[model samples]
Target chain A: MDVLSLPFIQHAILAGILASVACGIIGSLVVVNRSVFLAGGIAHAAYGGVGLAFFLSLPPLPCIIGFSLFMALIMAAFTVERRHRMDTFIGVLWAVGMATGIILIDLSPGYNVDLMSFLFGSILTVPVSDIKVMAAVDILIIGAMCGFYKEFLAMSYDMEFARVRGLPVRLFHFLFMALVALAVVMTIRVVGLILVMALFTIAPYLTERFSASLAGMMVTSTIANIVFVFTGLWISYRYNLTSGATIILVAALFFMIFIILSRFASCPRKP
Target chain B: MAPGGDQQTTVLPEGQSRAGEVPDVEIENCSFAFNSVPVLRDVNIRIYHGDFVAIIGPNGGGKTTLVKLMLGLLKPQKGRVRLLGSDPAKSCRRVGYMPQYSTGEKGFPITVMDVALLGRLGLTGIGCRFTREDREAALGALRLVGMEKYMNKRIGDLSGGQIQRTLLARALISNPEVLFLDEPMASIDIDGQSMLFDLLGELNKKMTILFVTHDVGLLSRYIKSIICVNETVYFHHEPKISPDMASLMMGTGEKCPVEMVAHGIPHRVLGRHERD
Candidate 1:
């Protein structure tokens, strides 16, 4: 019980709640819009920014945020056309970004950074300042979602119809990708880049089974993400296991159970 | 189920006729291509108000491209397209579109009500909450399509016919002056198709309706005229289509067009075009 009183544990829990807001809201749109692959590319490619920051002796978070946003815009451009081949292009970018990060880290003189933490997160050791940043990112995501809920819904469901309705699809898409980039960067300390996409997708995918609307899915996914994070944190603290990996495992397990249970659920009435 | 009776349709006095009024849709010398391969060339058409028009063409014959041109989803390589007497891009908010049912993700967890309400996006500013009026209009549209009972249901739970109807409600929620439907009958059964067309027929009385379909024989009763597009475009002012005209329009390399007319519509008939 004293573990809950520890400042680090409190920060971890608060960070998880903040990250869940972005994870749940943007994650729903990402999944429904079929932008998971694109998001994965941005998450991985963001490492290049981290490396650039290390090499340049600059602040890591801002550098990575800018770099990831730039990368996300490029990915968005590539995805706007030739959607059939988007996965292939995004895969290429993902590899290139990670490779650039590794090489840059190697070139940084006398910088023996603990790369494992960035790769798989050190949520238990997150500083209070980083939690504030996560809170700000959560605010950004929530504000954007609230302001553009209708546009996001329409575009996610039928893009052509949205375009026909004059919904400014391109501008919203650009802004959305930017928000996704920020979410990915902020989440790096909580789950790291390797497991971030799992956090982003798993809860939303599971919630989609029972959710009847976009807003409902977002709320449900937020609760689910928080639960997964807390459970994983507890298991990690008790068993002395890796926190990020344990969290992903919990999510993956729940996701599988949801899928299995869904099959046994009543077959939805077909039109 | 009597949504039409409960909600009187919005009637625009100036929209009842083509004479002495701006055309609902006007495309002049419009040409388009993808990667240097021309899809539609020199397409010229004028769709009048209160007209129920069907655009028929082969699989890759630029039918969708033409609709996209009018919807301002695509820009013509040459010439201009006007909707409601202005560039379609400028006036797109006043139009409604029901894309082919295939565009829908069947497993998506959106509610029927949410899908229908999306049609009001043009009226309700993006990034804003829907007004009470918007919700009422969306509900009215769902009622009109007889899917009001399923409004709270998940779209993934609906049947194909029901999903199509929900999409129709989404398109209709905007109260558009002109409605464009692309391949609305692609997935529906024969009976569903008739029912959907009947709904469209009822809708046509209040607004201009343009739909794209490959099922030519059964649609004569619902459409006021036909626009045949196969690389080029031709507007047949009458509903009666001859076998020769259908064959020429279809360009399926068959000498005789497969004529499968519905039995009840005796007033409009299509036989061999003896002149051509």
Candidate 2:
């Protein structure tokens, strides 16, 4: 099939929609929970998965997903379990996670893994099977987030305060971690895990500045994310720019524009 | 959920002739040290139900540490800290806790109502949905703290006193049998602190309160009993503001030689009442 053929292009376009849904939904939660950095931590940790897949001759996606989820859970647990002096531990884990990925890749005898694809991204050849997986993950994320929307929102703002009020903060923390892990795994394909953090944070952050409610922020983030991804795709296609780089550029541009608009607009009314 | 007097009746011990066991809280041989430095020594103390107990001492006197132990956030190196009749962790659901100087805690973009509603989140269900009863309970707590009107406002936008009130609501909403406030009035204006003191005095009707502060004078007007800590433990001293107590609470002659000898432990005056 020709590179520019309509069906291939249409498939890529469909993949973009799925990618936006996954990124936007997860990004909204990540932004609110202040776990954007955790995404970055997980992304670097995910390199271990890719390296492991290469070394064991396993399918890259599942291996990568398993490792990424494992890393995400470990990181999440550190935050909850190591309540005191957690920053010290998380900093160490971030370094360790990244180091593990780089070292493992180095040890994967004679296999020349394309490190650039993970660092930047190469969405041009995303498989239909991967797209289907992303769609399923998207459905799960959106459904579960909506199901526990109030609880997640309540906990994100204040865990101890919520716990005192009887909010089952620990259970919600675990549930939110599960969603984050699943979302991070799904997002790896679209922007590559390396650049996923930027998308996960930037979209919802822009939306949150203007949104009065958590639900509104999620909706605004999804719409803005679709725009961001599509605009990135179009720019990369037209100008032959890097798809991942182009998406970040588009997201950043929108963030700036939103800030400028809010500046000119009158102060937001208190709810 | 206003608990009547005798909230700690369930926590009373079965053994006979234990002098240190209070009806509300009991710490037996409690010793805590962070890195060789002792924050709290082998401390034994008790607080009875319906008693307004004030823990007054200098900075680094382990007042906060004592509160954390009572909340079960920290474990003692030597002894046990009990709340109501169970261990602090097991009885956490029955205890209301408020940390002081809440104005300094940067609130993310969350509505005040939702923040107040947090107190009811876990107790309502597995997923912690807010039922009508829960909503009513949260609203009542807010009203009690004079922050009902600001319930819909963003937490970050609140004034110092308002933020303190929000925290108070978060603590009180659960209607815990025992309430602990660590410097709850620290950041508020003097007027606000005085008002809060009055509010707390009224609150003593049903629940026992343990307020941790460096200055006992500010709290002396209402508290029924006092406990002082300067690495060691002092218990159930007479709740009167003598010149020595006034100086300790004012933190002016904070380290003066005349220290109130209580519970057979000598307290360093400066250590008992830190100025800041």
Best by DockQ: 1
| DockQ-based CAPRI category assigned to the predicted complex of candidate 2 | acceptable
Residue-wise C-alpha lDDT for candidate 2, range B49-135, written one tens digit per residue:
788888887776788988888777778989888878787767777878886653334446567777677676557665436788878
Off by over 4 Å in 1: A81-84, A266-271, B1-21, B189-192, B249-269, B272-276
lDDT of 2 at B39: 85
The TM-scores, one per candidate, come to 0.90, 0.83
lDDT against the true structure, each candidate: 0.82, 0.71
- A33-125 per-residue lDDT for model 2 (tens digits): 777777677776777887787677778778877887787777777786436676666667667867777777778788564666666776776
lDDT over C-alpha atoms for residue A220 of model 1: 95
List DockQ, one per candidate, in order.
0.64, 0.36
- Give the per-residue lDDT digits (tens) of candidate 1, residues B1-276: 111123222222122345687898988888899978999888888888889888876677788898989988888889989999998889988988888887458878788988888888878876679889988998999998889999899888878888888988988998889999888877777777777878888888899999987656557476777777778776776665544345545445532233345465434545433443
